[model samples]
Target: MTRSRAGGGQKKIPTALNATYYAQRASAGLMITEATQVSSLSTAYPNTPGIFTSEQTTGWKLVTDAVHQQGGRIFLQLWHAGRVAHPLWHPEAATPVGPSAIAAQGQTFTPQGMQPYVTPRALEIAEIIEIVHQFRQGAENALLAGFDGVEIHGAFGYIIDQFLQDNANQRTDRHGGSLENRTRFLLEVVEAVTQVWGAQRVGIKLSPSNTYNGMADSNPVETFSYAIEALNSFDLAYVHLMETSEADLRHGGHKIPTSLFRPIYKGTLIVNGGYTKETATAALAENNADLVSFGNLFVANPDLPDRFRFNAPLNQPDSSTFYAAPCDDSTENCGFEKGYTDYSFFSQLEASSRAE
Candidate 1:
């Protein structure tokens, strides 16, 4: 199942509400939880979940246990936001760290509200190793939390994505310049991640041609090809490949098709991005994807697989409540409980209609 950041993040600590939410959708074949930060510094926005602390891990355990009780397999997406992070989350108001000191153009949501992006402090060599260790630790925490597996978040212009692309990484060390160099950090993290979960239980999420967060690689095909080639060495379970339209945002011509990497990396290929039941069927029938993930659709319909099985009408998701902050006003209420788990199943909807 695809994960959505709907009406969450306001609740700093992971709560039973989250467990209840995931349990409601536990029928999915394999569920990937929302992007979870590896450390406190990995937090880019307020209310994002973390796996660094005992409290956080224990909280996630509740989620994993709930899903397991319902006989669902789930994986946690371990993430590091890189330069997208704000000092508001930092202990001493420190600057965010990235492959380079370049500041991404745009504002990030913080506890105080929207804040302008700041030029990040370039991480030291030691810090780079530390980041890899942090990911390894995050995997350990996920194991303790009873996750079936873990997916490394190397997409969406996050920390790993920042280093993979040419525009964001401008370093002269062995860790930058050529495609091989740019892939070093990601490969290193994967190595660490594999140590905790093993390659068969590990997976990666990558956005090869995406330009989100002002990303641009000189040669996306070559860069991702090299990175994926290295990834193949690990013999992972699958590579969750995400694709996006370049028209709205991002550089053109960099959009590499999913088939391009199929031969390069021989493993399970899960595709995500605006996929519908029909399109996903076509993709599978055409052998373009091994699996397809849906986000908002799953949010509006907990029994999504069954809905597709029965060709039932899907609930239209409300955009206004997609990411709304918590509300206390009795007349105007919106939050995790409302937008997260309140979506009715087909049976519930039918029962309500009959009563009406």
Candidate 2:
């Protein structure tokens, strides 16, 4: 979940509010920070954090230190927004780059306002290689920032997904066409990042049936099957799989369940997508997944693990404040803490009831 509170600048440094937010949720078995840009060109939305600069790295150090003090493990999610990014946010107004020149059929939040995505410049082979290096450098920076590990953001119709899915990638070059060719960029990035963090400290996320950002594949089962099997070669920390959502179905996406890939993947599998405590427990009991990740639930219930242990009621997330918005006199507790760090813990609720 992108909190979008990193304050505007070329550096996009994480603020103390970010440290407070993650530290509050340090009870989770593992905490993966919001999608962080690998470079300036990776900008997709205003106020999102980046890990490319020295200042940004130092800022993340605050977050890591806070989490570690609470005995938590955190992984930085490295991201490149690719064509989903707009020139309005780029330095000198550079066009967004992708595997092909096609533009996604949607608009993205920009400084000017919500703007339709522009046709991106097709990345040359040399440029693709450079982006791989950028991921590697981001991994090294994560180490400097004192993160437990790094997860490559290969899912969610981003740069790597742009290459993996045919709808966004129409190139006739070696980088397109077959499944092997399309997966080349993802593999190269994984290889490069693993060189820095080693396989045990790295993970990759994949959303096979995701249709967000206008992404679709003619044969998602085959494409992702091969990708997951190939990952067996690397003893990565885990392969995070997102189940197809209602939004994906409404967009005409194929229903490729995580169960379909469970047998194919050889290592740790972390399943996500609208999971409740019952469903997550059932998944583990049935050996469907090694772990289950929560997004919205964690956002609202900072002490989620304790809530689950006690089978207590949860705090529902306020969708309007899911992402950060501009502060104004009309909005109370605006900027970072409204729907963020202010979510009460189960212990607090218990104390309140006792007082009453």
Candidate 3:
């Protein structure tokens, strides 16, 4: 790989070593892969993994095989970054597509120093139809790669969320304009993906009040309730909600009334977004969520549940090695293997302490 460009290497591309990373954490009842691109055009960052090619599918198969060998369940997080995408990762090197021509107000890490996001090409109705096919194809590939199921990355101002939010989607066609129209695209994708993985195994991620990518709805409570209601028809395995009622407000989104959605969405509800072990336990006990997804806690402690059960002190995460982007596109180990599979397990650390 080439040298890290100035201020780059933020998103590490998953590699064969990722199999080791997942395997180490296979003691968990469930594991979810990092959000992987459905196609080259859908990629928002360099070195991100895609499921569209044989090579990528084979790489994923290695990860899945490793996880299953340990009797663990895992699901692939399917993503299309939409306007967060830049031309660098697009096939033929073209501008990224969005529900509308408006650009997201943020910078994306490129081979060079962070570049301002480009104004995306507004997707035509026909292109929107094509994306449904892409999601279906991605789910089928995930099945072939041995994923237990697939999680549609519909949250955080990506393609599906772009279509869902009124500020981002300015279309007058069947894909946009009203609440029903906005919800239509997501439902179609759910339908398409379920065709490959079945409704029982399919899940979705939603950020009802996220403003990470300039996302805000005129009526977030009503807007999101309509979307959640639509999912009830699908019998989805779960709905992963990013509880953003508390966030850095300067980023610009409103508080999502997370409590209001519990009745609207009848499926298994999973909550994420900066949850601590204590808060997670509280959320489940209070019936705020059926499951909680941890990020750094899981990263620093591979056998995370064990630590939680015994009231073990948690290991702090290393901020520097969270993600690695290869400057020259070389795939070997991505960048540094520090924050990934190299993170010390509690057993390993305890053994070292005894040896010392």
Best by TM-score: 2
lDDT, candidate 3, 1-356, per-residue tens: 01122111223334557778789899887787788877678767656677777677877898899998988999998888899988765656789999999999878786666889999999988888888898898899899999999999988889999999998998998888899999999999999999998898999999898887788778878888999998999999999888774552657666665656888888899888888888888888998889998877888888887677656677888767676654544546335566766766666566456556
Estimated TM-score per prediction? 0.91, 0.95, 0.92
Candidate 1 regions off by >4 Å?
Answer: 1-11, 246-253, 326-334, 348-356
Inter-residue clash pairs, candidate 2: none
Model 1, residue 337: what's the lDDT? Answer: 68
RMSD of each: 3.9, 2.9, 4.1
In TM-score terms, candidate 2 sits at 0.95
Q: Could you tell which candidate, 1 or 2, scores higher by lDDT?
A: 2
Which consecutive 10 residues in model 2 have the weakest lDDT in total? 326-335
The digit string of per-residue lDDT tens for model 2 on 1-356 reads: 88877854555888678899999999899999899999899788767899998999999999999999999999999999999988988889999999999999888888778889999999999999999999999999999999999999999999999999999988889899988898889999999999999999999999999999999988899889988898899999999999999999999998888988999998999999999999999999999999999999999999998888777889988999988764322222445778888998888667456556
Pairwise lDDT winner, candidates 2 and 3: 2
lDDT of each: 0.82, 0.90, 0.80
lDDT of 1 by residue, 1-356 (tens): 32333222323345677798889889999989888888777667655678888888888988999999999999998999899888987767778899999988678777678888888899889999999999999999999999999999999889999999988999999889888889999999999999999999999999887877777777888888888888888999899987766541444535578878888888889998888999999999998879998888988988898788767789998766666453333322335566777898888565456556
